[model samples]
Target chain A: MVARITFESVHAGQQLPRLDVPITASLIVAGAIATSDFSLVHHDKAHAQAAGTPDIFMNILTSNGLVQRFVHDWAGPGARIKGLKMRLGAPNFPGDAMQLSGTVTAKEVIGQDRIVEVAVSGKNRLGEHVTATVRLALP
Target chain B: MSGTEKNNWLEKVRAMVGREALPPQTAADPVNLPMIRRWCEAMGESDPKYLDGTAAPPAMLFVWTMGHFRAGPGREGGTLLGLDLVEAAGFTSVVATNVEEEYLRELRCGDVLTQRITLDAISEEKKTGLGVGHFVTYRYEFSDQKGEVVGRTLFRVLKFRPPAKTNETAARVDTDTAGVTQPLHPRPAITRDGAFFWEGLNQRKLLVRKCGSCGRLHHPPGPMCPDCNSLEWTTQQCSGRGRIHSFVVVHQPQIPGFQYPLPVALVDLEEGVRIVANLRDIAPGKVRINMPVEVEFVEVGKDFVIPAFRERQAG
Candidate 1:
């Protein structure tokens, strides 16, 4: 019962609204069987294009669970995720539709919790995928 | 392409873990936080207390070593040597450049976590425009349920190529004298609070301790004051100099008896403290960025020694 994304409706370069997400190899083998990560370049695509990876390669624990399900479905449900950092430039194949975006650089409050600081990215259709650093915790 | 298909995928990963050492079946289950908030919203991570853990943010304990799963037998032979070194080198993709972790604790949930992988290193070079690939380095070590050690993961695998065959000639392996550059034999006894900072770095002097309550200056030696835990200190001596805040030429050879390009350095001393040591005399793509350095002291086994850094000589 928590869904709130409203730091005055966010500004500082506002974007957050891309979320395409398609990528499937059975959803990356159900996210490598929910993160036990048997690693084979994330589930062997002929050993991930023979270790030069072109496919099967998005398993930094499902890219941190798709950046915690896009900030818990758009910063809601009592939003409280605090420190996340993503850095894996490319690679999220499967069926590939992937988009996921974000912006609001800083909103601020700190003491009684009301921080924002977003700058996420995860594109597709061949563009600029994977690039993150979200820090929400508003109330 | 012989030797039984190069030991047939490491004997099918040693026949799927056939020398059991007892340590697999780990998933005490607890950290699901909506599957870690749908993997931090597919890594767009809007860290709301790592998706509401009541405010737990310590690098989300690096995703609590990703849940857990360690059933053995060549433990799937390191995933069939990444599918036999990408079907015997025909590379052109594999990316994950840097991911240095070193957290020690703070991973809650049910906390069953237990990993012990050990495919320490694996190498292969030749990149005349990214051609002859291979650079595997896995060394997980996650432990939980009281045993301690909450983290340490170093999984780096590049492998990408497409140009190399003008008459092949880049495979002359076997030459890794551990960390190389040796000399020190019997010299370890810097005891109690790093005995006068190893007697002022064995006389070559470069001491630093200052901390009369957070005045801060410590280097490698600690007994307190990581910013005012202060045991009230004092030592001073650094003139040995510094600079070069970052470096690395380590032609991906993951220490297992190393060799083939190694130039590690992170020096920043002037009593400021940075130390990641090991650079010696030049070469390694020249090295730059504040340059000017000093301090040296090799020597491998036996009494063990380490504190390397060079390049310094201006007015």
Candidate 2:
């Protein structure tokens, strides 16, 4: 099992390690089908083209999963995500690369656990793909 | 991507920001085992709590709000005509960019959820790597049947014009169901007292045990009647007519062997006994509290059947 992060070890202004992820057509489509999102734009090339996109692109569910994975991997297994707020900035199309990074913005002791807030961003070659804030609890 | 066109497009679609993009609707199913299994499989999550039916993963909070493929009209709010408006303005492509959810409680089986959605914000035209478009956001409020707030979410998607045919080849259609199968529900745990209830279901009969001493009835074939506390009891066939006492549409954990948005209900039987069962023959969103229903047995697997309810026809 991966080692867990303790509340005492984390502090504001700490930067998490960055991870580079290669985006693919299959990755984008797999996310849609897995989440039961049947929108044509996420998988159908002809339909997506007609809808005015370069190709089928990643869905929000996939982006959310990526974001979740990015944070949990850093916070370790025992950490609980309290909340997440995100905004889409760029498209994550197939054949592009996404690099995810984050910084601890604030930490406070709430009840029995330490609640740490992190500002995270996913950027691709085109530019920023996703930006969001995630709240997690560490014991 | 001209300035004049972008301005015009934003102006037309911006009118929807304060409107109800999606109508309030009930979930089709209560939280169940089948959907939960599927979600875990997809996400590669192996949390023991989910598998043992202890607590659903908090990340799945949004899944309970989703409408299934065969879902009826007015059930979808986020991608309503607002997206169409942007598409018409030549911002023809759309992709979900962001999602944030705050879970207030753990979802469990048999908990019915109702959700209301409001369009929150629409960004002005902006140029991005994908193309020139606007970002639209929706705020979703989820509550259980008791009207307790379960969770809230803010979702954002970008509607943009696609960059010129970028990928040399078209997107491939995938037909990859390598290891997927229908999920068999957890079998009923039959004890000496409950054995008769299971047997009744297999016999296509809905039975409520009646106290031999007091004639007071109790469902689930208890050893002793609750009201009279009598050990001796006999079973009585039910009339199968009832009203929906309470219900919940389950959305999460995507377990196999069942459909999404499954509706489970607590029925107030005409015999004055209450039983919990799956509701059928009606759209999950269309089921109303106190709606009349009748019991029916559905054959799920070989030699196994479960009681399900259907909307009763009005006289």
TM-score per candidate, in order? 0.27, 0.57
Model 2 spans with C-alpha error above 4 angstroms: A15-24, A52-54, A94-97, A111-113, A124-127, B1-17, B71-91, B127-129, B161-315
TM-score for candidate 1, please give it. Answer: 0.27
Best by DockQ: 2
lDDT of 1 by residue, B1-315 (tens): 566764665454344432322244244455557655654444445545566754333344445444335644433323423435455545535555434344455465566666665554545443422344656555566677777767665555566564322111111112236722121122333546777766565565667777876677877777887887978788777776788899888875343233448788888887778777668768888888789988876544322346678888755
DockQ (C-alpha based) per candidate is 0.10, 0.15
Top candidate on TM-score is: 2
Error of 1 at A99 (Å): 3.4
CAPRI category for model 1:
incorrect
User: Which window of 10 residues has the lowest lDDT sum in candidate 1 chain B?
Assistant: B166-175
Q: What's the TM for model 2?
A: 0.57
What range of 10 consecutive residues in model 1 chain A has the weakest lDDT sum? A48-57
Worst 10 residues of 2 chain A by lDDT: A48-57
